[model samples]
Target: MHFQEESIDCVDFVLRKDEVLTVILGGGKGTRLLPLTEKRSKPAVSFGGKYRLIDIPISNSLNSGFEKIFVLTQFNSYSLNRHVHRTYASNAVHQKSFIEIIAAEQTVSSVRWFEGTADAVRKVLPYIREQRPKYVLILSGDQLYNMDLADFMQNHLIDPETEISLACNAVPEDQVYGLGIVKTGIGDSIKEFIEKPQDLEQVESCRQTSGQFLANMGIYIFNTKTLIEVLEDQSLTDFGKEILPKAIQEKKVKAYVYDGYWEDIGTIRAFYEANLMLTDDIPKFNLYLEKTPFYTRARSLPPTKINNAIVNKALISEGTILNHCEIHRSVVGVRQFIDHGTKIYDSIIMGLNRYGSLDRQSGKIPHGIGKNCEIRNAIVDKDCAIGEGVKLLNLKNVTEFEDEFVRIREGIIVVPRHTTIPDGYEI
Candidate 1:
């Protein structure tokens, strides 16, 4: 089917916020993003230095005037719950809007945890039914993208017969192996769906005339009745692997082509690359967007303090204190303290959670990077204490190695959160 570009007049189509409920899937184990997900849930993992992974989708929903959101989390959800509560709790009082965290719980009928994406929503059907929303918007928590969900919802409403509208992007053939590919017959009508096509012929068949495959962005808008109907079959576990393919055959599923910067931060390499990409002069994902601002917890802290630091192409978040350090092409997160003579390049330093009192009296290593350290092409997770003269360069270029204090994945060193590397340590 030939697709044409047309202007969408959003002024005529007003979306009632109360009629749509946003459900963010945050229960995935995030095994691919391990070590980072060892302590926190996938959504709670830090992203772009300042914001958590969940903040991207939640902020997008809020900016699009969809305020009633439910974040479903299961594996290691304490931090995720706390963040959502603290950051979005005030919305309930001031704006009459709320972003609630729905952790998995054992019920009379189900004693197990969330098995997959569809299963997670299926278990929450009772709570979803109570909301009485005309449409339900499902989003992934671990992706980095800014979308006007109101626009997406408007497109879904354009076709009354579109029971489920999937937001898709045209990706190259090489990128189709990890994403769900769709085949369209007519304008925006999805005829066939395949999850992670591995066979060469299967992947080639799904490619469009433009020589690009329609890759699912894991963003879906479903009629409330249709969602409930699809989840009625308990056999279906995952959305991409099971639910979407069956729904395309039996239900009216459409495609909403999105031409924007979207990156699925599923692996450590992807996460590292995505963070570093933000340091570019013209990044694909713009965190500095004015209208659709990225929202997170409001920490009333002092501004970032740089004292004679030579920094270039770096994203230094709020409340960071840099002293005579040379940083280039890196992302320094919130409340970071880099001592004098330290040099960081092509790295991501996830800063400390708080300031002050780091075992000074006990002679223990304090939080933040110590003096004279050289870190390159690495990821320093939150609240790590690297003693003076420590080098995390991974000079040998080992692909995979792990120890008590550090881990090297895909040739990038990862110093896990709350870890302490003693003085004169080298890799």
Candidate 2:
């Protein structure tokens, strides 16, 4: 999606004159990205090799100049919290930044975790109310995309009548149910909103006869006043399931068409596909946009090296050394070492989790060169020593696994770190 002329103006300036607080929703268990999310929340899960999933939104906020940030986390928040403090603690951006973790709590009236997205925000309403932020920017922590939320907020400000502004992208007919299907008027004012529809008839009806269905991008800019009212109303618990539809029905919500690479990494396949997309010759999501560049905690390491390795369309992070190995269509995390004669294809290796169940891909073998080793279409976690002579090529049944030695999720095998499957073993 190309940026429309109107959006260009939205992105060119910081629209909100008042102080804005960015509320990052980081509460999902990410069960769909299992094995990987087995040890960490979706936000703490490493991505693009070196960066964690939370970095995507934090970076977006820093680059967009939205320094005041609050991340709401419920399940598995330890690692997520540590990552934030370590990465966003001492940068020039940090001087003006306030990124913290807000977990689920229990009060006298209620004793449970965040019930829903709206509830998550509502529970923290007092905290935000104390800060008196003029606008509250609510964002998801697991989606893979770079949006200039400043642009989104600007549009909402310009459209004075709007109480809620949602950033959305048009999706295919079959994929509409995974997100909120919205119906809007000509000038992009939202008329109606429906949470995930169950059937084709509902999908077609929400498509607005324009043949393009607007799927929520999980990015929202709310007028703090309206947001507080909606959140306190107890009846409104989820943004997609209640808040949004209610707002649209009241005729005050607007839709901002987001024309950029936005992918909901809600499943293993979607996460894998999004990572592979980054390895393209000229990726659809341009990471090199200077004006509004994607910012992450920089590693002051040397460059990567592929000696005698036949590398093809892959992203290898800094301090990585691949020797006589073939890597194709994969994302290798930082400071990783792929020994000679090893071949990795169509996988994602998050090198940070290099021990215990923390890692995903298990090592090929310890030592025994009787058979040949071939790992194709799999995610090999860090510190896995794939010994010589073990074949992992499951061509006929790509999703089949012989033993628990290698775990499979949505057709991707996860080899946990430091796992030693002795060589000559055939699967």
Q: Highest TM-score, which number? A: 1
TM-score of 1: 0.95
Give the per-residue lDDT digits (tens) of candidate 2, residues 1-427: 1112233444343334236889999957788877677667888877788778898888787667677788999888888888887776645533544677777888876787888899899988888887788889889998878777777777887878888888999888878867888877867888777789887687676675667788988799888898977776886678888888777766488889987888888887787788878898888776667666555567777788778888888888887777777888988887676666777788786553322231325533332111235677777665565556666656555663436567766677777555566655545
Instruction: For model 2, name the residue pairs that clash.
Output: 360-415, 360-416, 361-381, 361-415, 361-416, 362-415, 362-416, 371-389, 372-390, 373-390
Model 1 lDDT tens row, 1-427: 0001122234432344668889999957888888899989889999888899999999888777777789999999999999988877743243535678888999999998999999999999998988898999999999988888888998998878889999999898888889999988787899889898877588677778899999999999999999999999999989999999999889999999999999999899999999999999999999887677888888997999999999999999999999999999999999999999999999999998997554556778899988999999999999988888999988888999998889998888999999999989998
The whole-model lDDT of each prediction reads 0.88, 0.74
If scored against the real structure, what TM-score would every candidate get?
0.95, 0.87
Off by over 4 Å in 2: 1-17, 90-96, 107-110, 208-210, 300-302, 352-372, 398-402
